[model samples]
Target: MSSRKAEPREYHGAAGGFGSLQGIARIELKERAGPGAAETLYRQNKPEGHMCTSCAWAKPPNPHLAEFCENGAKATLWDLTSERCTPEWISRHTVTELRERSGYELEMRGRLTEPMRYDAGTDRYVRASWDEAFAAIGAELHRLDPKSVTFYASGKAALEPSYLYAVFARAYGHNNLPDSSNMCHETTSVGLKKVVGSPVGTCTLQDLDHCDAIFYLGQNPGTNSPRLLRPLMQAAKRGCKIITFNPLREKGLLEFIDPQDPVAMLTQKPTKMSHMYMQVKPGGDIAALMGVIKRVLEIDDEAKEKGLARTLDDAFLAEHTHGFDALRHTVENTGWDAIEANSGIARADLERAGDVYAGAKNVIGIYGMGLTQHVHGSQAIGMLVNLLLLNGNIGRQGAGCTPIRGHSNVQGQRTVGITEKTKLAPVEKYRELLDLETPEEDGHTTVEFLEALLDGSNKGFIGLGGNLAQAVPDHERVHRAWGEMELTVHIATKLNKTHLMPGKSSWILPCLVRAEEDMQASGRQTVTMEDSFSHIYGSIGKRKPASEQLKSETAIVAGLAKATLAHRETRNPKLAWDEWTGDYARIRDLIAHTFPDEFHDMNGRMNQPGGFYRGNGAHDRIWKTDSGKAEFTDPTVLNACGIGEADGRFHLVTVRSNDQFNTTVYGHSDRLRGLEGTRMMVMINPDDMERHGLADGDLVTLIGDAEDDMERTVRGLKVTPYRLPDGCLAGYFPELNPLVPLWYHDKLSKTPASKGIPVRIVKE
Candidate 1:
């Protein structure tokens, strides 16, 4: 349950052998899931069982005995834990007292058992009936303009719940539905849609199996998604070249011993994962990708001159894409000096990578937040798409683009219409088919919502799930803004900092998680989740609900909708709230009716064992763009790292430890990084540490260079030397969120540029 209280030490062992087993054992022992633990593990990733609550990796048709990763197991165990935070227990502690507890400590307090409301008289939370909470929330919303309220959804919820959440919001007359994707991969959606006519990844797990090479960029698969390591390891074992570009040499990508591989686990032999690893500088993804693409074009030119087999997929490019001349001009104008200076990669090394890419027949590119959390985040994605297009890697069996999604159903939430963009075709279709009254103007994103609250424009907030206060940048600003809201409602499995940072009137409602049984009136309900690859799978929880008072997300959303829409008039005359909540299939039916293209047979597909894939137009080479072809965007003006002043400052990137997933701090241990007992440590290059006159374990303060006249500093952070790029630094997220300004974000998608934040480190 607790991490080891020892000094940080280097972990030289291969990732995911005995280490993974030990982590799983610790979670099992701490959570005390009893017999349910074993059953839950067995059910994880199974077609008929609940989906893994961790990463959004696609499940294979025939899975290994252990398809779930250590983090996945921990998530399930944490959800199935016997401990409960009852109304009485919460009533005993004041909001101030609970706010003082660390995130990990609050998580350890266990699942919330019932609906509760903040009592100003006692400064504590007391039990409240669902009717009372919903009525009070409805009254407040009725008093304010519908555009002033924002509805946020987390990726943890399934498609059914997300769909109902969107419908509920539309019925309440606003399109302010922002989810987890707004902060993480909004750029992925924006960029890919512009370039490839598809927002989701075009490839599946089968693509990884057949791809000749994979260019993995800006992602730490080991800690971010351990299940992903399996495919990477398998690819490496089969002699497929796995080229990686990341500032930190992640343990999973470097070398990995599969916990499920009996031979490797028994022999303690690790498989070398990344055939070629390039330590790219923070916020340098655009330059790095451009350099590789430039080299690929050069190699193609040489081949043309030599009269050998053409290096580029000329036929595919000519027929399927446009803007090649513009792309070539941009890359040619970018000098090697600037490329090397920005990317922290030498020309020779980049050429070597380009050689591998040019030689490979099929190269699949995978990326994560590293590419999407920058000022030019969307353009960075465009660069990667350009790399894949150069070789005709897309619309094929073994090649395409893959965005490693963080949450289990973040993509799914967006798929089912949880977004602030009212212009999206599917979103508009949902509004049209449902005959709902929604605001015509585009609504606020996560950052815009926070800004509105700060500026006194927004008065109400309804969060389906997520620790918004801690999950976003500018933690202090978010906390302060949240305190000024007139009404805030959160439906979650447990208590978090967001709940403690209550508004004038706040309510916390307990809900069933992925691993719990939800016995609706129609029978035991099953929810569907769409993975990163667009595979939809049915998930029916194996364990019973944590408490009898807990309700399913669909039920809660329906209850709130019924109370809030009682006096409101929408386009839809008849609203059957009880029937929809009683059977989730009705919600799926509406989803199919709204977005028939993707979810035509969604309800029927749930009956299939392995589920079905939502067809992607880009995968089939069906360009739905204005030109009827894929766009090769110009990357000339998208090269800046968004730093205020790079001189004498470190490009600080926020990262998640192995023990945590997003804002949920499972513990203080970052076993993969050899860190324990603390999350308040910065990983810096040894050369940078020497330059700053600091040693390991020295307490330092990081001052943000927002240049906005607002002072931002994270003090007393331990300096831990790492093998990062010279001017780059890595620190755990949320703790370092304060260093990022609210105004700094990707212009196209409004995703907070969490990475490459310029800061000065001062030793205390």
Candidate 2:
């Protein structure tokens, strides 16, 4: 018989709709015995006697009764599932077999039970002892030039482990450290650092409560950062004006009927959100922001002329900022006609938004990847910062810039010095403290690392976490790079595509998950994580370790360092790898000494119930620049390459569904968007569809204009007719990553052009 082609399910409007019904059926089917196989495919990663680690780590009696969000619950459920994938199972299966499975299927296959190494000769992975794996990895490191090795860390690991990895890499004489941050929030760091002298956001989650007006630009906090919704809902209830600016009208931004709210649940009424909404086209945020700024300036000028009051905070600007004249000239030169045409927003709407911002005593601006994924993303952020500076809205009680981070500890990972360009002063200080030689040269970023891999310059890779191939754009290029590596080591809790990359010598080292107990040399240890709000909190495992064989990421790093760094004893007498495993406090002490301003007296701070705030420019409106003020940068041309016109093509913007997080696909469904059990769909406006002779549920192929040969055929895709702009089209990422060339990244940040890819669509 021929292989069965899966038929697409049609949408049905119901509380438990067609998609939900199908999901229920799939769940039931998986629970039933099939031949000799296990009844259920889904299993948690935690061992027996699992508890809430986050609750224990929380201050005092804990901030709330429940310390987890819906996504966090899902994350924990997967972490503590009763599933196992032994090394013997992998030994029986070839790499080709594993590659054929879906990403979800591979992940649900189970936890890594033992350390395993890829055997190139047999084309299978074989069991390798932890000691043997570490020794092999160390040997490879010793063989290669320090600069030839790249250390890519993920946000999964605890604070101690990440810090240890950073020290190990620097001691090994290479700063080639490209982390998960390189792909997500690198633009925020780059933009903020240049303007305000800090890479982190200035506001705390508590600030959301006090703001009179909150401007959400280019972000979907409901799906991306659900924890933020509670506060937003509370603010909205208290009559705070919430304004949203994005290309898509996200369901979360519309209104949320909080399941936790008993009154609302009983009444069956949802709180309304977004007093005003504006949908700007892709790459149009800069012009929109500039329009608002220009409106604010005009308002201030009018007030000054009428002798009503000085709307411009001239005193604050003069003392706390620079480059105002150049900024003024640029804004003055930009015509309203150009701004309206480019932004797809009328002058009146932008004027109203500016009025809302100007009228509020305390306002906050929150943004996400939609504002940072373009070629001019950094510039857009700078413009936002400049606007905030003009109003003197930062460093106050309820006002600041907030960049929503993706990963749990993404901000913390970068905070502890994970970067290609390691600041020389800090490295020297660390060297002096540890009595070790510091590497002089800077490291390679994700883009440069890929180039190095392609050219056979970088031979080995140690990915602390994340599926590099799936997460990075232009995955084919990443796949080829993985094939060229001599050694590929993945320290993770579960199996991922990056582990199956098959290097000359590859090892998958099973490590303790975040929700599992991390018993180092220290008894009952805890890890620190910095949230997007800049609040530092402690996290301990709620459950027992998955297996005794599994080690903490800290121990693994120490073992690898011991094996790789030959002259460790000469560095310092206190540098005892064995002793270091016993106590994470010592690591904290080292961190405190290194980042005195941030982590001073770690024990004292951790003992407190609620974690203390890290230092941001919020205490005083002091900018950390060469001129000791916020610098306003104004480029001559907004877009080096002008607005992408739709001659015979549509501008494609890659997006994530409500269910997905980064590259980790929990399920192939988006509950809010009405997409069920399928990711192969594109959202386009009715006008665009009418123009192309397409209807709902029509299969189409997208052809890239960058090159003639680049194209992707997506069949049986439901073309959801929505109120999207005529020239714009939206689709999910990774699958659409093929449409974006690696060479099409932003010139300044080297971030992939994921948001805006010029492509023509046709019926298949």
Candidate 3:
């Protein structure tokens, strides 16, 4: 095979102008959604249309006429493409043939049009009736112990199906309800619960408007969540001091041009985004945060000694917080020498950041996978909170921690009870209201889910949406796990690798996309979704279904539930599976009843164009903690990748390309990085590249070794020289995801340690 060549071009600013429009058009045209693209985009942002599945960034209280960004447009268009996949066409391509195609190639093939079952005899997917698929799944589920069944969901699914997914698992006597959150922002949930007594970000999306200082730690907003750039640009224009710490100085973080602004587009001049940029090495977030906290404490002491207003909030601390003195002691005891050496940031820089942080009356600290996809991800997240609480940042206007979540409605999934660790409150409430007796024992997480599949413990799997096999690490081992499952079912839209690699008895239950209308017995129905900030709103798809046979995920789940729960429904007569499928508003009422305090008036409130807030206690400074006060936590010196310089190993962090969203590959190009026509590229510092005797465009192999000394290799990744911190290398994921061992994750969250992996590079 010939190596694909790509040319590098520099991006001067963040999203806006012709580039954003052109990028959207490129994929729309590729998917053949060009004719009605404008109308589709209109409904995508309109009140009557579905929510943007691109980013979970909260929508405005009153959204503008134009609400979505370029990425949202791309996401909507991709899902509502004109192309369709038929059983005849699917049968034409064998599993082996499909396996050879790239993930991008598979998605581009078009939407799955009909229910299909794997026929191993012919090595092809043949059409199956909905009844046939459900019966098979129900039979398999009944054969296995409820404890052996795993009910998984994707971040893309709206609230209705996610609710049914959780309810179905519990009613069937299992707690193995794992979703995308386990692989993404679970650390934020775990860490925040310990510190602020809340699992979600304290600040709402509108709160960013009040912040005078914004600290971005190890996140690239441009590529991951482009919609976030709009507020960052507005904040910069208002003269807010924005400081960034990451291995790469992303173009989006450096400058931005609001395509919404006419003058900026005409002038080619961009808004200066980051006033200060610190290129801290990977695995340094914990140390860097401690360094900032130590500096802040030192300033507070000096101010107190001078009889001036102190850096720490005295009244807030005395009344609403605990363990401050111990946290301060830890920060002060962590030597400056260790902080600087570990963080790859100078002490003077930390002091400067502290000055900026103190100068601004309101501040917000934001982070992404770079903080949570590590061995000590939970500890790292708590350290950020410790830094924020020193000045009482939480509950302050325009000031708090924002764990920028990826994927739409991922937070909502957790809010409605799709978790491995089932809480007693929600479980008890469901049993009381729904008249159901569900399991109490907690189930497996994402890593543990696959591990169970590999062992004999787990025998069945049902996915709501997403390419699970591709998203998890240790691809080969995951394949082995799939092969072990007695039955597998996928509620998906696009044809991906996971569908091709099926269990002994597998079914591809093609479902409706968010961009298409989901009509049922009660007529056209609308589902509810909550954003990252907990703004709950209604999403009604306007576009007609791509195929007549396509069913909503809600309907699919309902049919499954109706069939599966037939035997157990005598005692639980209130289980209204049919009503939920008929009118999604009924699901909202059930949800309101299940979570009364947070979800009151669910049916009426969601109808409002702007939606409603679920209300976080942190937003009100009412910490629902064990002590009824916000608590301080001691910082831990976590080794992100567990690599030593003497070993000649590089810290590898898996990343998404500019054109990709989660596992969906729009194209091979990453516009922000100026790389096009390929995704098989690895970036390393010039010094490290030279040390390995490699040059730009040179092909190299990446090797990851386990503690058992078992070697796993990904061959022929082209090297690209970057201005990264020494000992750090970056590559696009789904490709590098295999290098991350299943065991290498945050002890609490179990999120894939995709942000940091230890590997050695060898010339191919």
Candidate 4:
């Protein structure tokens, strides 16, 4: 054999700092082909090129642009790889065999070329044709009650594809559409909608630049949303005060050097990030936020007593709000002792933070999953908005609420109506537009959708995109339910474990990668994506499709509709499937007619480089609540159940490593924290380690009860002691996703309890 050895795993240096963390040994967590494997994976996936043509955010000229952040680059490379999951390949490897592989390795294998069906005897998948697959799906739908089918749409889908998916499901006579948003930012939507009329954020990117102060709660933009760093740096350069509150000391929140800045990168200089950092315990956001608001109220009262112009915007509040007396009573009656104890922050610190907000001329509050993945996440977000309204921060230039979103187009997916609960006007307008009957009943949420599948109430599933099996909590239960489906359809660019959970008749339809041009009868087509700032932009692919067999998401949806719903005239009379092929204009026309104020002349606007911004409540200081004002919620004592032991167990908070994003595992490298090639490590405080007789690099096992009876154990994890809270330990998600029970979700939003899972760790 040749003497050329495999290359060692590569470390990309600290994510933000000029140098890596000191004292910590450079630990290669696994024996993967280091950073070279990343490049190899990229070349394999992108036989055509490394750039993503589908994302407007992708940098120009350089196909593998540095504009691609670590996670984005990983996603792009994984999609364009040269691997293939052909029928023959599946026949050789059983479901059990595939299950044994890590999620990262399995997905890295290649694209799913042909439609497939599950074979019980062989315990493997076999090839099937598009006609046969669609016929089987249609037959199943025809046999079952409409409610028996649950349609799921992932953020990976384009607007046209998602709209068609929703239309098809509604026309088929069911409203069981449970989507990815139900598990992520459902709380943001529910809380914001109740307070602001619109479920989306009230601030744009421009607001960040002009804001005097920014309060960041429960969000880590560095890992989940790296692209947001540019704007954040710009805001910091303009002398904005950024205050961050979280359970762990996130490196990204401290300082960052823009990778795009040649001078800064070359000189190894970094921009200062958070002006004030407060370590709030898990599930402590509500109390912490409440404490800040109480301080603000006291300060305003003091200002009034001193005859200084009242700190409170009295004129604005009197003109725009209601429920002030009730709100005032609740805030004043609450004790400072309880706030300090529950929030784990000192009274002085809370006052200082509040003073910062009160002194600022304009302020914006930004948050993410940290606030939404808890039992009282919705209530926590509500408190943030209430604080903003106290100072008349709404309907202003630099002041509003911004919720940083995960997934490139997660916000856009919701914009196109991939919701479990359909609004009446949108449904009625769609019906009038298409001349079809719209389903009125609200569909299932993610939790309910899975339950329906487990109980055999739902027989068919159609996933527009996403790794549902891995993304959902309680993997054992979700995987079992997924295996029992009658028919399953996945439109995707690559293979994941979700695709392997074969239904009786499963179809893994290959779709064009985001970087590839979507060609149609009309000509080359462009798609629209809504960024976190609510700005819509046009994205046209610059690369060719990996193969002629691969189709655009739009084409696939249109094709599926033509194949299944073509026979039904009443449900789809105005729907000439051909007209929608590669023509996003028609879709825009429909969207414009439905949401006239926001999407007016959407096609005409697409020609402009930077698309228009969606109107937000920040412009008019108008709160959309029933009282027409933001209301304060009393801090309530919250309790979590099903944690087995009261002592010796800590809340195992699942977080995204610096290199990864959401459920998509780009690689096993956390450059900012100096972890490489492995994710089976947990961060613990050194003091806690000494008390537990644990040491650095000690092999341990994490055991936890997902439900009352169901338990999960992850073994052979390396312990890495750090500066986490006394009763808290940190681990990466998807790997630890099994420990989170599906039933243990936020009561209001139905989001997985990934942030506060109680578990016991012991020496293996």
Clashes of each: 0, 15, 0, 14
Each model's lDDT: 0.86, 0.72, 0.82, 0.71
Residue pairs in collision within model 3? none
Q: Give the per-residue lDDT of model 2 (tens digit) for 575-653.
A: 5667767888888888788888888987667534446666786446667777788877785445322236758777778
Estimate candidate 3's alpha-carbon lDDT, on a 0 to 1 scale. 0.82
lDDT tens digits by residue: candidate 4, 1-764 = 12332221223343443332211112212222234434432432122322332222312222333444544545555555556767788778887788788877776666767767677788787777767766766666666677877878776676667677777777777778777778778888787777666677888666776899999988776666655666677788889888888887766777787666679878877787888898887777777787888889998999888888666888878887666666677778878887776677888988999999888999999988888887777777877887887888877889988887765566677777677776622687776788877777888888898888778887888888788888888777778888787878888766778877888767777788766667887788877667666766566665556666777888777777766665555455587667887577787787778678888988887545335676766456666777766655544552222243367878788888765656666567676665666899888877778778887778998888444788777788888866666777888888888888778777677887778787889897
Angstrom error of the Cα, residue 665, model 3: value is 0.5
Q: Give per-residue CA lDDT, model 1, range 576-631, as digits (tens).
A: 78998899898888888887888897889974655688789999999877788989
Q: Which ten residues in a row are the worst by lDDT in model 4?
A: 21-30
Residue pairs clashing in model 1 are none
Question: By summed lDDT, which 10 consecutive residues of candidate 2 come out lowest?
Answer: 37-46
Best by lDDT: 1
Off by over 4 Å in 1: 1-9, 425-433, 569-573, 637-640
List residue ranges in candidate 3 displaced over 4 A.
1-10, 568-571, 642-644
How does model 2 fare in lDDT? Answer: 0.72
Locate the minimum summed-lDDT window of 10 residues in model 3.
1-10
Model 4 scores a TM of: 0.90
lDDT per residue (tens digit) for residues 1-764 in model 3: 22332233356545566688788878877887856667767766457777898888876656666688878888888987878778988899888788898888888878889899989898889999988888888777777788988888888788888888888888888989888888888888887887888898888887889999998987888888877888998999898999898888788898878777788888978788998899887778888888888888888889899998888998889998999988877887888888888888998998899888877888998999888888888888888888888788999789998889887889898898888886723878787888877776889888899888777788888998988899998887778668668888999998998887888898999988787878887788888788878788788887878888889988898888877877653656777888888888888888898888989999888867667888999888999888999988776563454544546788887888889889998987788877777778888876776666777788999988545455678988888877778888899888888788888888777888887788888888
Candidate 2 TM-score, true structure as reference: 0.91
TM-score of each candidate? 0.97, 0.91, 0.97, 0.90
Give the candidate order by descending lDDT.
1, 3, 2, 4
